[model samples]
Target: MTDLISENLQNKTGLVIDGAMATELEKRGVDTNNDLWSATALIENPEAITAVHKSYFQAGADIAITNTYQANISEFMKMGMTKKEGQDLIIKAVKLANKARVDYFRLLHKEDRDVRAAHPLIAGSVGPYGAYLADGSEYRGDYQLSEKEYFDFHRSRMQLLDKAGVDLFAFETQPNFDETKALAHMLKLDFPDQHAWMSFSIKDPETLCDGTPLQQAIKYFNIFDQISAIGVNCTTLENIEPAIKNIRAVTKKPIVVYPNNGDIYNPETKTWKANRQAETFTDLTPKWLDAGAQLIGGAVEQHPKTYNK
Candidate 1:
């Protein structure tokens, strides 16, 4: 396998990842507040999932991170869905993104008559175990699970997404070393042909949510060849530059950074505080790129309109 995504990311600079899928879904009137989060729309409103993907393509996204963030089998089964149904939904998430890419390409070719309009890639999203807990441990990263437990939780989803044929894996919003290490090892040992970009949610510029230094974590993660890019996501705007600098100093891999919309996430309240306008986020893009982020965009509070800016 050629690993087309790694090739594309290596060849392209300033690659624009799509903004928040859940935020866009909420904007379109989908309630994303339950344990299932955005993944609920997979069963209740799948068309809405495809619609968000289309909006991001229209907004100039170079990659569509699939809406499988909260679509794990165990959780779906708890919601009265069968194991097969959950797997089918995960596969559907990838298919919807691929359909949007095909549809967008048709429009682009008809309008511009150019093949150079950055062919979009679909990245299958694998959110951390905390996202399943829905207790905000994704930002805290202090889970008490063993590596085997972590693997058992994530492997089914990763396997299903792989079978669905996404262009790459996005092991994103991880906040601890154990989960990251376990997932990285799983990918290396089980799916060596595929590549993934692992991003973390940090407590600050230097520390991950688990109190591990970003550089120290990167040093361990960078040793894995299956991890194509290493960086951060769902972090604050102010911490991005310093965080990227720390990662950049240690690894030669492509760096990806997608911070929140210049707002503070109150884990206790389960809401964003003091959300700023898109312009505040747009202003920070240049600095993040200047700090050496190859793939940059926004998470949660960001919309495609913001991505367009």
Candidate 2:
């Protein structure tokens, strides 16, 4: 097993770092704007992404997600790139992460730390289709595609990411069972060596959009041995409690939970922001950990200091 997954199995609490937009922002000389997932594909600077990963490492994060959440062909087609071009991005993404790992070890060694002797883990992030797959919206959805098509779409990227040597294969922001099954199967077929984990999104609805109960969804996927953990992210902190509670009822596998900024106060607009005022690293993490969430992280609006705080 890779060190990342092994540590996750050992350390009950694994920290997640999301720096999707770090490269894009640095290229344009801007800070993060939209959700990092979309804003990240704008810039192509692997070095900038590495620096952000380093910051997350310093923040005490055990796992750092590469900035390739939207680096799939279907998503990149919007940017006018061909399928091959988008696929090549994965190789580059892996190299970028390896660079981040090397740099992080160098920094730690300089500070008299032994992180180099220990193993480090890098996760290659796979975000949902730019549109929903179950019930595709007119603009974002492109729902006409069949389930097999969706699976095939993601399959191409999975193959490339597997070759890149990511410690695990991660599917994030999926809202239903169709997505979960399709992705899990593809990963098993192509990247059997890597671990697979799923994260569902919380909308206004009670159950996830695919209509599976939280526990059932996890139970169904647990049949696959490669699933090291199951949890949720990119949603409200309020959702974390219910997610943890439900997921805990089903399986004993490690639980990973990362909530977005929860109820933040906006200075200029005088408004409370969920993603805007999202949870800091310190706030509410203890609640999740105490509540049996084996892993903790910041989803939307995640900063490197989230681990430090």
State which candidate has the highest TM-score.
Answer: 1
- Model 2 misplaced stretches (Cα beyond 4 Å): 1-4, 11-13, 16-44, 110-117, 130-145, 204-206, 263-280, 299-309
The sequence of per-residue lDDT tens digits that candidate 2 reaches over residues 146-244 is 578768777877778778888887777666566677788776776767786787765522356555566777888878878877887766667787778
What is the Cα-based lDDT of residue 272 in candidate 1? 57
Write one digit per residue (lDDT tens) for candidate 1, span 93-145: 99999988888777675544232224567889999998899889999998878
Indicate which candidate wins on lDDT.
1
Provide the overall lDDT of each model, using Cα atoms, as 2-decimal numbers: 0.82, 0.62
Candidates' TM-scores?
0.92, 0.79
Clashing pairs in 1: none
Q: How far out, in Å, is residue 20 in model 1?
A: 0.4
> What is the TM-score (0 to 1) of candidate 1?
0.92
